[model samples]
Target: MYHKKMKSKVVRITCIGLSILTLAFVSILIYSFYGSKKTIQPDALLHQYMANINDGKYEEMYTLLSEQSQAIVSQEDFILKNQKIYEGIEGKNLTIKITKIDELGKTQILVSYDTYMDTLAGDISFSNEAYFTKNDNKEYRLLWQPQLIFPMLNPDDKVRVNTLKAERGDILDRNGEVIVGKGIASSIGLVPGKMSDSKELDIARVSELLDIPVDHINKALNATYVKDDTFVPLKKIPKDQQELEEALLEVPGIKISDIAVRVYPFGEKTSHLTGYIQNINAEELKKLKEQNYNANSIIGKSGLEKIFEDRIRAIDGYEIIVVDSSGEKKETLAKMSPKDGETLKLTIDAQIQSVLYDQFREDKSCSVAINPKTGEVLALVSTPTFDSNDFVLGMSTDKWNVLNADTNKPLFNRFKVALCPGSCFKPIIGAIGLTTEVIKPSDNYESSGLSWQKDGSWGEYKVTTLKEYGDQVNLQNALVYSDNIYFAKAALNIGGDLLAEQLTNIGFQETIPFELGMYPSSFSNTGTFDTEIQLADSGYGQAQILINPLHMASIYSAFVNDGNMIKPYLIYKESTVPEYWKEQVFTKEAAQIVRNDLIQVIENGTGSDAKIDSLTLAGKTGTAEIKQSKDDHEGTELGWFSLFTVDEHTENPILVITMVEDVKERGGSHYVIQKVKTVFEKR
Candidate 1:
């Protein structure tokens, strides 16, 4: 019985021991399961907050931390400081994922997370291992060891984004060929905050690599600052080789990014028409914001680009990434693809444009060639033009200064800016005289080289002429010879008020409303002129009359092609109708009489120089006096000749107009007519 009792006691003790062991195992299993189930622990949450802070998601990341953390860092302080850090991360994809959690004593936790980061500028992709420490209650958190962290958050990450870039739009010839588009150009970027620790960044070494001066690298490194534990750069990295290399020495921190540059292959050839784009400065930004534009972009400084900026700017896209304490990306939560700008096709013929550019290279001249029937501009040329490409990739400060200070004003689009109609105004006046019945087509007048006053006091109204031909000269002979007296007589008969009214009816004295602004040529209204001299001078295409080459071209188009004044247009078609205009302005018959007379001028008058062998052309020439100062008899003549071809075989007419300003030696209009002859012969 005693042995049996002792054995029973031993068995009970063994059972108790087994139960204790099983209970301990079960408790451990439960703890392990809870720990492995991804529970939101204080330390885990603190790590996430630190990651958020590093990634620049301060508010949400802050929320994840315990109340103690919030007390330690106020929302305002956190925002202000993290904004600097966040700026560094802008345009970068950063994400983090928790990989492990380790308890450190009773009050601290070490959390490890995996990170992935990408920078679009350098096409760089990086993966890193990171860790952060959190208090037991997840209240306060900090980077466990910043130096040991492979992917330390850079302070300059923010300032790098703020650096100015010259964003450019594509350049297309009138035919829609890509003359200039987005091109990749190598650039260097510096993270000021990243390089704040100058010891880690060897300026000389970097300068050697990038071919920049050591001083430059040192300057940039010194410019870095920390705000809310985030580093911000002070300046952009130098594009110089030494500077770029020195910046790269910091590797993942002092980054080198690529910039999109504007390119114009045609160079100076299409400069005037296409214009140029430039980076937006602070002042420009203010204006852009007022105009509802994106502040972080470039805008057309002049030419067609400025006129059509809305159609060419690319819509910005964004990506949402989750980052970790080590400033590495964990995942991409969402992405919005960028929308490319619309491609614009122009009506400008590159070949014709090149030809026209060459023609005016030696002189201060402007020309406008358009399809009279459609008002499609074929070639618009202005001399002393600059390469639109110079405006791209940030023109050197020296180059910019020279261009801006040039006396000739190469930047000005002389075709639209300088008004000098000269003899070109005659055809329009003739058309007015014919249409308004101010003078009959068969009306006759006599000229003795000059029109005189009844007193013959030297006629105070001597107009330079080619000498009188006969006693009775009709409109045909007068037009052929550009007889100043004949037109003067006609002007007297028609009256200045009536002439001005008629000219305005045909689209003069008003802004030539095209896609671009046209400089209005000066004009005046005079009724039945009592002064014979005023009437004669007006007849000879002088006396306060001025018009743009483009305007002159459009008006002349009306004269030749059945008199229907087609509104001059730039864009052939648009997806949507433009919002700022309406109505057409001139009659077909009115244009025909003018066209016939103009054709006769080309056939036999001063414009005879423009005659072509194969194409029957009609045109007129004018050399008007340019008034400089009172008592200073310095006469600078403006020459003009406009014509349209009468294709005998095709029965299709093509219009061309050429204007040359301030011709000192040969008659300006006469000189231009010779040029027209060359153009026609070539065509």
Candidate 2:
């Protein structure tokens, strides 16, 4: 029995031993397959690191670092360092492309990657290598260092950024004369040691003269860095304010130094043309983001300064570099050279503009002067002008409000706008009548005192003239007498369709092709005359006709240019050539007939007051009434005078159109004619 039990025990032990071996073999196979999988590829580890960076998961990236790297940099320090450097340059769109994974041995790798990112300086791209190793747990890990962020980064290295300011451009006139140019402004300041016995009194006097506050001056003088010898600046005044400067110089302790400033030589005279510049606002920055404009940028506010902003503005440059502890540049990472703004030359005569402005200062008026022979614009002036320099030098809120609230509309730009042309449009009607042969130059008509109409169909409306001359009047005689009845009859005979067609062909109800914004001339609010009464009134320049003064100047040129109208241009280029706005707008015969009559109108008619001494001048006078109805006798009136020198009596061949509002009580068209005469006499 003992022998049999021993045999059974041996068999049992052998079977149990075999089962243990089978389980051990299966466990070995499973461990071998998973352990190999746990060892991450070098490229795969690099891709994961980059993905964490792209997601801004810097903590995860720190965990991917090798044990030696973790000891070198803490998780908090690593995250903060990466955050500061990347955000310092406004970096975005980070990408890392693993180009190659080199295996140094079984546990280490040298992975090369191409890094790219966009920043404020533009785009940055560079190639670098990432060192990686397997940790004790057999997982791949990065051997991190500061140099991993930037290939050139070292322990003491620093990223430096700087800006190169772009210089502003100048505004030049036709003769290369500086209009808006660089000049000096008096930097008003005081030396603490040089102050007189009455230091407080002197400072107070300066404050008043500069239109500055006493508190501001006191704060500047009391600044922490101020010394007895330091000249702490308080304010900047225009250099040309001689009287004010002299008064301030009389006060003790005041020291005036010259500082560079933007100058408008003509001051209030050219304010409407040059406009001004100011610091960019939040709304403007939002709209100009794609153009790289920032909060510190300066922008043109109005007029030509605003119109050609891109051409006139400076393009700033930038530099990204590495610097040492002492702030010395070690290497230039990226740099862009500054591009100075381009100077723009205009077809403007400074003298002419100044003279025209002087004449209209007291009155609400506007004028435009053009060189009829070359199509070059000479002058544009508006009355009650404000100083553009005030905008740059900083205007007080009270002063700005005064200008904004003025009844004369000093801020309004009237030169490029449309207004009633009055009798100044008579010559155009006569020219068109002769061109289409709708009315003959010699055709005579009978005048009916001061008022007349087509028939009973005209209802309460009647055509009226200031005066009648003879029983029978020819076209020239009617034009000379300023007869509205004669032209009204002619318009009735021509019919509305043909007259409207003729007006449209003459460039009416269309925008003038010019650089500046010119409101188009229109026949009426709805762009058409609804009745014969409306049509007749339009023919005599009294209905709903509104023409831009610039367009009017261009149109009148046709009468003198052998039926060709000169194209008005503002910008002056070296290769400029004279061009025509309209060729053959009238037959030579038609243009000549109207031209001769205009000369007569100046010589003996309503325009006689505008004739300059020793000059062969031709002109027309217009007084357009703004009334509710034809029978309404009381309303405001706009006075106009269109004049041109027919001969070389002046240095330049000039054509001017001057208009003044509220001339009804004043001499009507005669008032505007006198203003033109004064402007011409000044030349």
Candidate 3:
């Protein structure tokens, strides 16, 4: 009985231990099952997916989409769509922030997020909703929806982007008349593909009709990438030439096509001021690519047209269009309207510019007129100018080569650069002498047509006058006669450093604030006067000095405006403030004295030919000798005439300056003087 009782107790203990171990194992198994089955939060999945998209990881973004969405749109298509939208944007970034989350069902969640991107227009902001569903695999996936790509997109519609360019602005004159704008012209050419296979037949026919060499046509046809269908422009034909069009059409593959081209109604009259436009070159296109310029873009090549290019260029618009599979436009999704460029009004008087330009019909010369008080450039003309229309409408290679090879250099802007001022520089020196206390109006210097300093200080320092004066000459008579001896001796008294300071004070070697930049006029101001002869020569506008017509005219305006130099300008803007250097280069009294001397020039001195009837005029004449070389003492002459007269209507002094180069066959300064008078008489 005792043995049986002990065995029963052991059995009871073993059963209790096995029961405890079983309970522990079952608890662990239950915890593992619940942890593995927990659903992923919809908010977390949506945030991660948006983050991938913003990082430009479109491929990763595609992987997070539900199986339903991936079936319709492939990862490659999604990437391409994103790339097209971001192509032209400079620095692109997309910001997404979750604002709210709505629970639709036990496994579906809708997330609302704010989308933001900065664009040229401004900050572009919008709200979008992404739907997420817990898939059978127990992980949340983004449901493919129309709003997933863009807030306004639809499932069946295609996204298309169209670039719309604004119409380029019109360049207008002071009177608001269009000076440069769009117009139609004819381009004569043969479609390379349409031409006959026999080179001889096609080349001969084209050369005969266009007056081009057969060899030239053959060369052009054989150029690299000369496809058969490409239109190779042979020449620009006149739009009115219907007969020439018919004649050209008779040739196989030869045709006339109308193309939009820049038109300049005034043509050569405004060539220098308005400039011209041409197709962008490789180098220019590269530099302008960031500005949306392309290979086919027409850009300003010279003058103000180039200077104000950015302001005159139109803004480009864009459209989001939906197209069918065949690439046919089906519907417009969104559009941003294009804006035309603003109208640029200039300070130029077209009528006056036209009249002045015609006056120098065949002469190679330059003339500039300005309003002294207002600083308005009324007229600027560089004669022997080529018609801008030739470039705008297009020219043959033969005509272009001839113009460039011509010795006359009609393409050069003579008004921006030229030789010395000649006697027209007298007033500048006279003013310098009086202001520096070097000489007085009352002080008389000996002028017997020639003066020589025998002192060994200046080797071969001799001065001569335009004409013989009496034994003595004062400031008045020196200017009236333009006596070189009187002015030279006066310049020697001030020395080089002081004279240079005065020249700098009066706008010499300074940057003039004009759109069409001016070449800096140089002076012999190295702070070293090697010989008195150099100073003496400079006093008469000879020696090492170079001046442009624009700068010379601007300096003379100071004389007319009581020693104030106003900045010259071309464009007119209401917001543009007037700019001027007001330091007293010369006193009011000295300016009046110079004015009287100038008037005496027209009345009794070298510029007498410029005297106009019933017009009170103050003027000066100058003739400068340009040495053929350092050793060639006999030089060509450059004639100059500067005049200022008060306008009858405005009561402001109107200053006109004319310069003629290589005047060997001309009438000297008198020729320029008459040109000025002719311009004034028209007024």
lDDT by residue for model 1 (1-683), tens: 99999999999999999999999999999978765555466445545654665556767855654455467667776567556534543434555666667776765566656655443222223434433344454343543222212344333222223222333456576667776676655555554445455544445555555445666656655654533334323223223446445546455445555555666667677788778787777887876664434555667878787888888765555554545656567555334455566667776767777777777777677888876666777778888778876567545555677888987777767788646465566666666776776666677766656544424754343555565768667776777777766676677777766766666665555777788787876564432344556555666677656677777777666654555564667765543222222122334555665667767787777787777666778877777677763244776777777777755354434577777767758766777776766665665
Task: Sort all candidates by TM-score, best to worst.
Answer: 2, 3, 1
Candidate 3 lDDT (Cα, whole model)?
0.76
lDDT against the true structure, per candidate, is: 0.62, 0.84, 0.76
Cα RMSD to the true fold for all candidates: 15.6, 5.4, 6.8
Of 1 and 3, which scores higher on lDDT? 3
Looking at model 2, the pairs that clash are none
Point out where model 2 deviates above 4 Å: 1-94, 104-108, 117-123, 133-143, 186-236, 240-260, 574-576, 631-634, 648-651
Question: In candidate 3, what are the lDDT values of residues 1-683, reduced to their tens digit?
Answer: 89999999999999998998899888889878865577667777777766665577778878888887788888888677655554433224667788999999888889988877643333456788988887777688988775665676565556666678787778887787778877778998777777666757767877877777887776777789678787777777657778878888877777688987668878888898888888889999989877767666778889877888888876677676556666777766456677777668887778778877887757778888887767778788888888888887767778899889988888988777746887888898888888777878898876545565636766554565657767658888888888877778778887888988888787677776787887777676564455667777888888876777777777777776777676788877665344665456787777778888899988888888878877888889888878854356667888888988843464545788888877766777777777778877777
For candidate 1, the TM-score is 0.67
RMSD (Cα, Å) of candidate 3? 6.8
Lowest-scoring 10 consecutive residues by lDDT in candidate 2?
A: 34-43
How well does candidate 3 score on lDDT at residue 638? 84
Best by TM-score: 2
